[model samples]
Target: MSALPNTHEVLLRNLNLVEGRPALLGVSDAGLLPECPVPGLAMTEHAGLWQSLAGDTVWEGCYGYEPEPSQGGSYDTVVVFLPKARAEFELRLALARYLAAPGAVLLVIGEKKEGIAGAIKQFSAVAGDVVKVDSARHCQVWSGRNVDALSRFRLADWLDWSRVDCAGVELSVAGLPGVFSVGRLDDGTRLLLETLAESPLTADRVLDFACGAGVIGAWLHGFRRVSGGSPIRVDGIEVQAQAVFSARQTYLNAGVSGDIFAADGLAAIKESWPAVVSNPPFHSGVKTDTSMTEQFLSQVARHLAPGGELRLVANSFLPYEALIRRYVGPVEKLAQNRRFTVYRAVRKTLG
Candidate 1:
């Protein structure tokens, strides 16, 4: 197998043999459980990571926002593998406060590059006292005790909601901490919307792949209604459980109906569609990687009907054009600005 992540290695090294079971939060597949096998819950939001720990006890939270108690009992220890997003870090800290037993020791581990010191500082707000227990492999492990009452931080209080207007459409977007571009619309998405308006693309069934906050799907639903087009069905697939929740709320706020599922890319989707549109995520944590987007481009053709099209907006610097041609079919640039490019690729029909 592969090596353990630096943060996980540091965490394992510094963790003392505690008396009771410990909860593991945001621990990726590369992270191994303690050799003694604690009975507490191992939780993650990434479906890919959750599936990797198959046969192991793992709980998949909807967007990595909430934590469920183990066997309905409070945990004596809570260990958090810090996330790159500040909002997500705070959310997990809140979970730590909610699930941790009074005076329970909360352990947090993270790479310095991801701001371990800042995380420790944030932990101090809710924790009684936070201190670095160990530092190695460029990662630091901090420990604190839960002194605040559970009722102080509610799950609903962690969500950040706001109204955003995109291309004259007002959106009631609900963003869970750490979800991308949470309460506001991003520039890339705005560019995609502009291209969608000018393009000749029309479909009765559509897939909003990587549908963060369900903005694209909601906008499509509203556009069709105002344009006097036939009623359309939209389905969204997102990797983050929180994004899936936000997408559902976005649809509700817009008075539209759509099916949204939390999945690892298109792994959970089975149906072929006439159109697929996305402003796909290219970052995993603090690393800029195209593996997820590349995987989608390489396999997306199998999920598209003949003559169906895949329209996506991406960073102008990304080499998606070549990948699109290799797997999907001929691709054309629909629009381009200073930083973003929109492309449309049609699936070739077989004779």
Candidate 2:
């Protein structure tokens, strides 16, 4: 009845593949709750859907751990929608093996332009064989069968969770496939760090808005930590479940304490704070969702402390400065590159 987001490939695959067959759906985007028009058998990770679907489900990403048994998921077939990241694809394949029952079928589908054909090489390692289905609308479908009698999801073997340094910031990160920045710091994030106006975070609690892998927060953890751990206790909020997990790992590895939660930006960040920094999330769920960044700015006025600062990075082409001015006091451009711009805003009483 309700509308669905841009992860239509999952929808299309579900419609084309599942025909009253019991199946388990492991998705990062919880928005898939509404699309189950006629639910036969599906377990979703998005928590909002669990109440309606009758299960104890939690919203989470593929890293960290696998979902527990619920309803038809036991002894049922599983289909994994390939994620955008190559590392994630590898991770999902391993998860799929764990989901497959004896003689269970694990089907995967993705867009042709996204290099699904190349993924066959990796899938073959886990599945005995990979079969291709029909292709339409620039998308391709592939199916793999797991015949392993003693099947266990190989999560540990797929990833190497280790401590690494990025630009002098040392932290431990479980950089799984499909996570933001894979195993290293993103260039945009580095640019944002450089652009952020140096405000002593030790004064008050800080916020790392849209923190991916907690790189900025990790770096700030050591910056001027007088006796206590950090001058400002950092909180990172990210929309992606996998991103938040990575951030948590980064925080733990860096010996920093920060809260990383999976929440829609405004709703998750509705609570007030004094200082905020970010490389605002621009890519929508499988689509371009500038509204999220736009909404974050529009609502930042209400949640921030008076005279608090908003520092962030975004593509230079985005019309965010005007949007920032609409909510906060003024926008100051600290730095610019070919593709992005870092902006600073201070909270001011609206006239």
Per residue, candidate 2 scores C-alpha lDDT tens digits across 1-351 of 344333344455456554334354455444564454433334343333433344424322232334454321233455666566666676666656665566676676666666778887887777777777657656666676766533555333544465545444455666555566666667777677554324334335778877767778877776545325435578887755556666777677677766886666655446777888888767744677787788788887887888888887888889999888888878898888999888888988855
C-alpha lDDT of residue 280 in model 2: 79
**Model 2, 243: alpha-carbon shift in Å?**
1.4
TM-score of each: 0.92, 0.80
Superposed model 2: Cα runs more than 4 Å off? 1-21, 26-65, 69-73, 149-151, 154-169, 195-202, 226-230, 268-270, 284-289
Tens-place lDDT per residue, model 1, 1-351, is: 678888767766765734487777787763566443555667777767666655565432223655544422377888888887876887788777777788888888888998888878888888877887888999888888878737445455755777866655666777887789987889999989878767735888899999988888888777777777777788898877678777787787787666887789776678899999989988877678999999998778889999999999999999999999888899999889999999999997644
Candidate 2 structure lDDT: 0.63
Q: Whose TM-score is greatest here?
A: 1
Q: Which candidate wins on lDDT?
A: 1
